[model samples]
Target: MNERRTPAVAPAALDDIDRALINALQGDFPLAQRPFADVGARLGLAEEEVLARLQRLLDARVLTRFGPMFQIERIGGAFCLAAMSVPDATFDRVAAQVNDFPEVAHNYRRGHALNMWFVLATERPDGIADCARRIETATGLPVFLFPKEREYFVEMKLEA
Candidate 1:
């Protein structure tokens, strides 16, 4: 009964400028008063243009997310990968309830027994378990937490 749902938004077309902007953003973003301007400068675009394009892309769902990735563990925070076996009939409602928790970084749907997967980020190490318990209480489902044993870094960039 696991069914894949199509994305609500249509795919967005990318032009050369959008491609260059995406590539440029993958590098070290400037730490300055006007970071967007700095990025625009590198791409030979005006600051306003850069902002507009970025906004448009986000609104069009071209980019699901745009922000810095933080190592929560470094700052005394914790992250855990969690999964649940959500019934097909109530999957969307369960997803909405899960996402209502600010601690959930993101959620995904997989075609498996543990079909609903998400990451929980908490300010304290113990908060992972607390959040999971709260989610279980809210959704009336069991949550499986997979804490990190070791870490590996992988840097990847793709042509736009």
Candidate 2:
């Protein structure tokens, strides 16, 4: 496996309000007609301010993703972790090809024999093998699937 070195990125600076907002959002988000307004009211901010701050954080790359996580298995879907040993020269291209699949939840690089790892969330359990085969055909590399044998829940919250 080829190790790719990436430049270090400086951590984004956060103000007190941004820190508060990040902490609050980690828990249950209010279900309301104007959710931002509700959040703002709790933090002594206006709706527009809350929206603006969140947008700014995202634009600055301070936040990579903000969204809901659903249990695909409960809905008759499947999530599989797949990996491939991509040649160094074609790693980026293969990553792009893999990401083109709509079922891919996220893809990341690792420093191992199987360096390219990604998660595939399909609408059906059998779709896992089908998607892996499609990826193998597309990338000309074998995809290794590791389906979960058991599930565990971990609550993770980071202070901004």
Candidate 3:
């Protein structure tokens, strides 16, 4: 029998350099095969130490994910943040279907008329529209697309 994997959510409270390191890494990680080597140099720690700390944080579920963010337009891909007015009664079922797509990066239920919102990223630009259509067909609810018209940068820092 296989164990089920559930969402890993942890309360935040990091200590000393661990907290500082997480905040520092909130910015761009080096675009190199040995990223920890570069990061370790800047943080005045050995690469192995940096790797171990990061592994510990991951094990504790303090960091959900860490990696690169690509420019979808430059790559000829498509991405968007979308929402649907899902009825409270069927929200979980509908959300499960939405999350079933590999393209969905994240999904959440928000307190609004359009309750279920999610981020979608597709390999082909044309696929975005078709994906929305397919989701609508499956859920029987219109998905409102919020494609990026302009670029915006939002930074979140994990503090101790």
Q: Estimate each model's TM-score.
A: 0.91, 0.83, 0.75
Residue lDDT tens for model 1, 133-156: 999999999999999899888877
Better of 1 and 3 by lDDT: 1
Q: Model 1 misses residue 6 by how many Å?
A: 9.5
Better of 1 and 2 by TM-score: 1
Worst 10 residues of 3 by lDDT: 1-10
Kindly list the per-residue Cα lDDT of model 2 for residues 1-160, writing each as its tens digit. Answer: 3322222356678999999999988878998899999999999999999999999887676776687888989999999998899888888888878888989855778888889888999999999999999989998899999999999999899988
lDDT of 3 by residue, 1-160 (tens): 1111224355546677787678768877788889898888888888998888888887776765677788887888999998999888887778788888878866777778888788889989888888999999999999999988988877766564
Which lDDT values do the candidates have, in the order given? 0.87, 0.85, 0.79
TM-score sort, best first: 1, 2, 3
Identify the candidate with maximal lDDT: 1
Q: List candidate 3 stretches off by more than 4 Å.
A: 1-13, 59-61, 153-160
lDDT of 1: 0.87
TM-score of 1: 0.91
Pairs of colliding residues, candidate 2: none
TM value for model 2: 0.83
